[model samples]
Target: MANTSSAKKMVRKIERRTAVNKARRSRVRTYLRKVEEAIAAGDSTGAQDALKVAQSEMQRAVGHGIFHKNMASRKMSRLSGRIKAIGA
Candidate 1:
């Protein structure tokens, strides 16, 4: 129902942005899941490596506005803590 030209343009922009954001979110989740699986398997080294990758992905999500700064920070903190616990 975008009657105005600007509104129509905005709708298109939003659709594109939504697709990009969804992909980013999915990628981040995949990284996080890998870390979790490694942790669950008791592979400390693997978990640590996966955590590093997940942290980077989460930070990128924040930079891209796909995730809030605090949310990304919180996830990174928790994952790091878990990884440390696995080592200890």
Candidate 2:
């Protein structure tokens, strides 16, 4: 479908970027899952630790353009709130 050499190069770049983005997304999800599991288990300290890591990963993702800034903030907020509620 790519007629020009430039277009072909663009296609290849996109493929590479897609694979990278997919890996980043999966990594973020894994961190989130770890936090969620810790929270569900009612381990406040573990959840807090995981949340810290997850938040770091999320912010890194935002920096990498994988997630919107607001979305990352919202997710971090919700996770922090949940962790706070664990003690209440």
Candidate 3:
């Protein structure tokens, strides 16, 4: 379907980028899930630690353009809020 050489190259580039992005997304979600699990278990200390890691990973994803800046910020905000509520 790609009629030109450039288009074929672009398709290859896109495929590689998609795989990288998918991996990053999965990694970010794994970190988030860890935070959620810690919060759900009511382990404040564990949750705090996990949140720190998750926040870092999320910001990294944003930096890589895997997530929008505001989306990452919002997720971090909500997760932090839940962490705070765990102690209350």
Candidate 4:
């Protein structure tokens, strides 16, 4: 569908970016799942540890433009609140 060479090149670039973004999204989800599992198991320390890793990954994602800034912040806030509630 891309007629021009530039358009074809752009399509290729888009494909590559899509794959990278998918991987990043999956990575973030994996970290989130780990934190949720730890929390569900009622392991406060483990959840805290997982939260640290997850937070880092999430912020990295935000920096990469995979997630909106506000969305990442909200997710981090909710996760932190859950961890705190479990601890308390």
Worst 10 residues of 2 by lDDT: 79-88
lDDT of 2 by residue, 35-81 (tens): 99999999999999999999999999999999999999999899989
TM-score of every model? 0.95, 0.98, 0.97, 0.97
Give a tens-digit lDDT track for model 3, residues 1-88: 8989999999999999999999999999999999999998999999999989989998999999999999989888998898899899
TM-score, candidate number 3? 0.97
- lDDT (0 to 1) per candidate: 0.92, 0.95, 0.93, 0.96
lDDT of 2 at 3: 100
Clashing pairs in 3: none
Cα distance off (Å), candidate 3, residue 41: 0.4
- Candidate 4 positional error at 12, Å: 0.3
The digit string of per-residue lDDT tens for model 1 on 1-88 reads: 9999999999999999999999999999999999999989989999989988889889999999889999889888898888889889
lDDT of 3: 0.93
